[model samples]
Target: MENPKKDSKKINDLEQNYKNQENTTLTTNQGVKINDTNNSLKAGERGSTLLEDFLLREKITSFDHERIPERIVHARGSAAHGVFELYESIEQYSKAGIFTDVNRKTPVFVRFSTVAGSKGSTDLARDVRGFAVKFYTEEGTWDLVGNNMPIFFIQDAMKFPDLVHSVKPEPNKEIPQAASAHDTFYDFVSRTTETLHNQIWLMSDRAIPRSFRMMEGFGIHTFRLINDKGESHFVKFHWKPKLGVHSVTWDEAVKISGADSDFHRRDLWDAIEAGHYPEWELGIQIVPQEDEFKFDFDLLDPTKLIPEEMVPVKIIGKMTLNRNPENFFAETEQVAFLPGHIVPGIDFTNDPLLQGRLFSYRDTQLSRLGGPNFHQIPINRPIAPANNNQRDGMMQMDIVKGQTAYFPNSLGGGCPHLAKIAEGAFDSYEERIDAKKIRTRSESFNDHFSQPALFYRSLSQYEQEHVAEAYTFELGKCMHSEIQERMLWLIAQIDEDLANKVAKGLGLEVPKSIEQPINQAIGADADIQKQQPPKKKIYLDKAPTLSQANTKFDSIATRQVAVLVAKGFSMKNFKKMTDVLEQEGAVIKLIAPHGGKVICDENMEHKVDAAIMTTESVLFDALYIPGGKKAVESLKKESKFIKFINETFKHCKAIAVDNEGEDLINESFVKDYKDDKAVFINKTPEDFVKAMAKHRNWDRRTIVKNIPV
Candidate 1:
């Protein structure tokens, strides 16, 4: 019988081999040890005579050049390091090694960004969000570049530059820093027929996600998936938030932009650090090759979507962002995403937008990163060893030892041979292509109003009202009356009632009808009459999952709760509530009248995280006012504190009052206090805790008056 000890000994030997790799000391480029990074090298007695210091010079030079050119579109971004685990084998759908092995845990880096924003822009901008992920698999680095919206504004890649330029700040003025509420964007929307569907989404709540963790991600373009048997299937990728899709009100989002420009980044960092890891389930919507043209819209069109109602998503794996980036510049900023970066079993479709991205991403990185050898950067490098004949570009890190670096070289004995099919070399699907080069779109791609109408019809009554209000607000900002009228006409095409609502708010009459298409030659059919009438809304069966009201709010994890305190506050009650909140994973920030420290009635000194003057009610999820006799008196006199309580009540956020704190609320302008869902009475901490768990009180908006205008 074979001895079990022999197998254990072999495993031990491998472990020892891995351990034998010596750990190196942290040092500078010149091999000098780094004693203290907190303080830079300085002259004696801080005299500022450090020109001869090599350490300081090197460090300053590195810091100065740390930033590269940010993405032209998705300039503002945040990233995290995580691992993706496959729950079950998907070998039948794809030969991708990462999906074949259920036991494998692949290292992943995910970057979420706001498109059309500068590097310094606010995180709450109403724009398409970039949700790109790079998987460092053993086979290679596979990048899935996607967006929060499943569909795009244009169908072809050639029109991408035009679309981006239209949405970006106008070249001459650059007035709107990170917003799409402008004349130029509205003009583009009115002129481009294909943009209607995406414009509707942009005008909706989906554009203002509460947090990066609460948003869904989608690969906008259809792709090809291949199995081990060489069988191919058309597929679209999706990443569903485990917390469920949720969004902030437009008013809340705008206020958040002012209160905290780094709201999304802060949320992600705080959540991960506090161990409330953000998770998403990896899902795919698959369609057979034969059914590619079976849908109403062409499979190659990027502007169309195969609704979940039509083809349900099959969740296959899970990804948890358990770690934050060690350094922002090195990890988050330098990491690049290219759509062309795919491993075996994963291939691209002929979707024009995707095809263009495949070329544009790599080309942009070459210039932005300053060289073709940008992949050599530690953060961008693949975990798998790269061995190829391509060599010698700017900043080349690899040191090749062969005499010949080209293929079919006798000097190198024909080394670095092409990988075989069994060795996991990428192979494209055998799709037939026999079309003439033309600047025309398929007829099936022409009917853009149907899906937009469907989306508008799909929203709940409250959501529809919000969408109408959002359109009015955004259009009111535009100085051009014609642009607003044209947009109103477009909206009317989506829904007559929606246009009428927005027009009423704008104090302008809606146009009788938008311009009839001058050039209606679309799709293969090219019948103008066929495109005149939008399709009947088929998705009216309320998809409760599409609404933000259904999102997970049971857990208060990662929620920021502002606790009001002062000298004479009830120490026992405050401690009890604080302990329960902390245990429930809520972060408490002590806000006092003064900035520094506060002494409790029990003679305990607690430091204030932020003064009432520094933070706003909009910055936190909930507010808890602990009873202190003197504290209540001081808070009553402070208008900012009163504003905080009043604004929190108006916004429909949870507000809890204890002891004498109840008297302060009674004196405030919140008159219909008893009917407000946010205002909590009685002394029990349990009721307050339960109210806080509800996240927001939707009923408060009806009764509360004198809310922040």
Candidate 2:
């Protein structure tokens, strides 16, 4: 499965088109290599630029129009090139080439984004993350446009615009660019009961992922897989990260935003560039069409997720992102993902949101990508050669060669003939539809609180506390008292205790009853009260899988371990820890008092990765202080070094110290309870590695909660 990109003709095509300017002369857009790139053509040495200078015009013109229209949503994004390899062919499930052909390496481009943010928004925003993947399979591109969470905020596509509007910055002020805490968002969530499931996830730790590599991805909709036998099965796709799901605390998240707004983006890019590529195991939850009605929650509802306990996830394949995009704008920015771009075996369901997305995505590309010829963009182009009579308009990069452009024409000897089922032509599944069109909510889509309640209940006590605190913080940000009150009443439906905590924070009571319409979204003839979310019913008491506590903690691969060092550092202590950690795929960066090189105890010089003032503790997963009498003495003089360790301790990150390093820790907040599980004092590197693998020592959180950095 390795070097999957090397075998992919599409990836090869991109590599062929990719240009490198290293050691080459600078050039204009017209490819005339220039020796005077710095000095634009001018009338005189210091005169104004001359309009007669074609080189200046060409360079400035390209720079002026370099910016294209950004996406309306999921605007802030980072992407990578990857390949998907199947472990076992699921011929019974899907007949798609990527699924059935075990030897085939499917090229893919993955884009991770924040939903509420604009193009310039911070990556650490508390909002939904878009995890969209475009697979260049033999048939065509299959774009699995999804989010980190399995469920979404709204179920109906018609309400999507409203959801985005409310969650986005306020209309008049445009305040709070990338955040969800505001009057409009709270107002919408208070009434739109369907949003509770995903909004709860937003309030939880999942929203603030430690790294993009650690976040789980999901295809929220219930898509279908039609096999060669013409049997259709309902399918849900899941990407379980190899590094495991993990997140930073809200306090850390805020600090990280200030310290490094591009934390996740940088992490993802650095990981790939360092050869510690991100990988995720593909899992599928397949339910037969006959068993669709068996679930308590509607399978077709975009707001609900099928508990993995009900139908176990089958690990099918693995997707490894190995390459960083050569050009951000050309590859990552211009990559358009459409939910409608599916394969022969894969088909859509009647999920209203998915249905609307099918039309909306293509329509969006017309404006965002500058026209209907978006597919001609190299990133969007498929490995499979496109042979069709469809002509293009704007940005028409392709030149279709044919006298007879019309289909079924004899003049061109039946050129561009239609493909048959055997020739791998796409044919829609023969799904029987025998119902009149009606615009109304399904009775099955009404249970909004059960899954949300289930999600809350499945969390560990500490996770639940975080959720409660999140609710309090978000609601406390709202300006309108009525909006906060409505949200309190809504939260009460999910958990009375959580509601009580949030209400207490706002100095408001959790009212027993708020209004007639718990859900204000009702039809013209429907009863306002009747349209309210149905009383939650517990089908399964606890889906332990829902909890982050249940996620993988087996390995600490690619975990960033900050090694604090100084001019007279302990080479022995440093190498001892680094050797073991690097063997486990952990990356250690030397954080010194100053930049450049620092001499060790052995008088050996080492390159400093970052200076104490340049980096923050929130940027690292763990901290290591090596033993050196002079080094520790130097660290003691610097106040920021102590604060760094203090913040790391407060954030529940693992901290390891040895020899004189113990003296440095003793001078800081680690002086108290140095015996904590995650605090390794004079312990072996193996002990620190084990502690780091656990992600964090949440049990130590209560004791260190009051630590100020």
Candidate 3:
């Protein structure tokens, strides 16, 4: 009834009140004001964590239950059934049967996943890959849940929720999917200096692996191995892929996401189904208990790794994933892994992050898989007899025979009794822990910049350039100038050249100083300046193992090779090339102008794998075109064929053409690269195989920048 202007003003005020949070204080869902949420409550600065930490429980519980059925972090996953065969017994290191029994073929289930994405997100996301393995040994089910990166963004498990929240899509506007090139992620990474080590890893090509079979897996945390003599030694786990480490370029990753969002998932399933099983050697780096403090960095720090140059990996066994899951929802979806599921010889360490995970993983499964009875699921059940007195809950699939639901009951004749320590029973490692309970981290974990600097310096020239470009792209997306400046300043601490490269790309200067206190992981009353990361140190000149350039290149098994053909493709040239390729276990896919069968020059009809517009160049590892005048003429009419060849050259993949096939290459951007080392012209099939085995012609990346596709 009042003036119209008054009504409009009232409506605007209401909108601001409901949407804006400028002056609001951060509080828990229960309305409890929190002062420090970065570090969990521990026994001492570096002692074992305490269970009285309610803040950690509440925050992680909320995060674990945020989504129903699908995992909150590693939502989109692909898994397989495998078997682990020990090559040699390491009886001196551990008493675990899997480590000591060389004749045993332990059954295993492995799940590979991408973090910071939903169940429906694209597989080619530039994000951390989750590499979790569940080993069903005679002792028990040991779950070695880890990631593709050797380190993580945060040091403590307490900040895991915060880390995931920052990298996840923004709540109000879920615009970006399966990506970290956004504002909120970098804002958190810049403030949390501990994240710098693993942050540099995410900015590298390792985040965009070419295939799940080609990427390495890491335990990421230090664990203790107790021998039969009760001696404890600190150890780290590594999984070296038999196919070697490989990755795609950022440009290729972008296009691949559009072309085949299920590239990795499909590749893995096809390889296993085609009898080309993926294999990875299990390796361990064992350090004596007395030698733990010998390194420049803390062994317990989750954000650092012991350089392989210092301690070489001792290959013990191999794991071969020879079978695909029968049902995705029943096996892959409902499978639960718990870090606490360890045998007698394998035990936990006091790493704060690992300490928190022992609780977090089990808690997450309780909520995700319905209840405590999830272990009864066929995929999660242990091989050894589970004679516990535990009772029913949601989704209880087991039926107990006796009426005794409690232990130490004579009514059930105490039949489900515990085994003695001598009868292969599990025993916790008796590590000494005498310290006061406190909510702080050790000073040893403060040197965050040193390892990141070492990692950047260790990379090859091409890898380093990719890192710079990645940083530039990620930071350039940030709208806030202050956040970008802060990141530029931090990157400068790692390397001046890298920082300058990113800064130049962003059209901004690398600031000499930033106003905010660096490293916000300190407690509410702790000294901020003391917790700040120290100056970057150069412990080693380079770790060659850090670069994919030094990976194995002896085989090209399961490599997808695209054979461009038409109605009159050269059967002679095709046979010569494909015979050698198939012998080496490379997959040959025929791409033509149209689908279905096409007749060759010899009047033989062959099936088509994909049509010109139906497939993309980024989906294959190499390209081959057989010699045929009619084939070249038909290929020239299809514009996508030319674009496909141009993209193959742009990505620096191997390319080979024979006789008139060169005519097709001449029509595309590959014509200018006649002298390129990996671009073969009328070459022998052995020569082409040799080039394809190298994965890609990385040197060609520098000169092919101007190629239009």
Q: Which candidate is the best by TM-score?
A: 3
| lDDT tens readout by residue for model 2, 259-356 | 99999999999999999989999999999989988878888888899999989999989999999999999998899999999999999887767766
Off by over 4 Å in 1: 1-68, 517-542, 683-690, 704-706
By the TM-score metric, which is better: model 2 or model 3?
A: 3
lDDT of 3 by residue, 258-372 (tens): 9899999999999999999999999999999999899999999999999999999999999999999999998999999888899989988889899989988888888888888
Alpha-carbon TM-score of each model against the true structure: 0.86, 0.89, 0.96
Candidate order by decreasing TM-score: 3, 2, 1
lDDT of 3: 0.90
Q: Model 3 segments beyond 4 Å from truth?
A: 1-31, 531-534
Q: List the residue pairs that clash in candidate 1.
A: 442-523, 443-522, 443-523, 443-524
Task: Show model 2 residue runs off by greater than 4 Å.
Answer: 1-68, 516-521, 527-529
lDDT of all predictions: 0.78, 0.85, 0.90
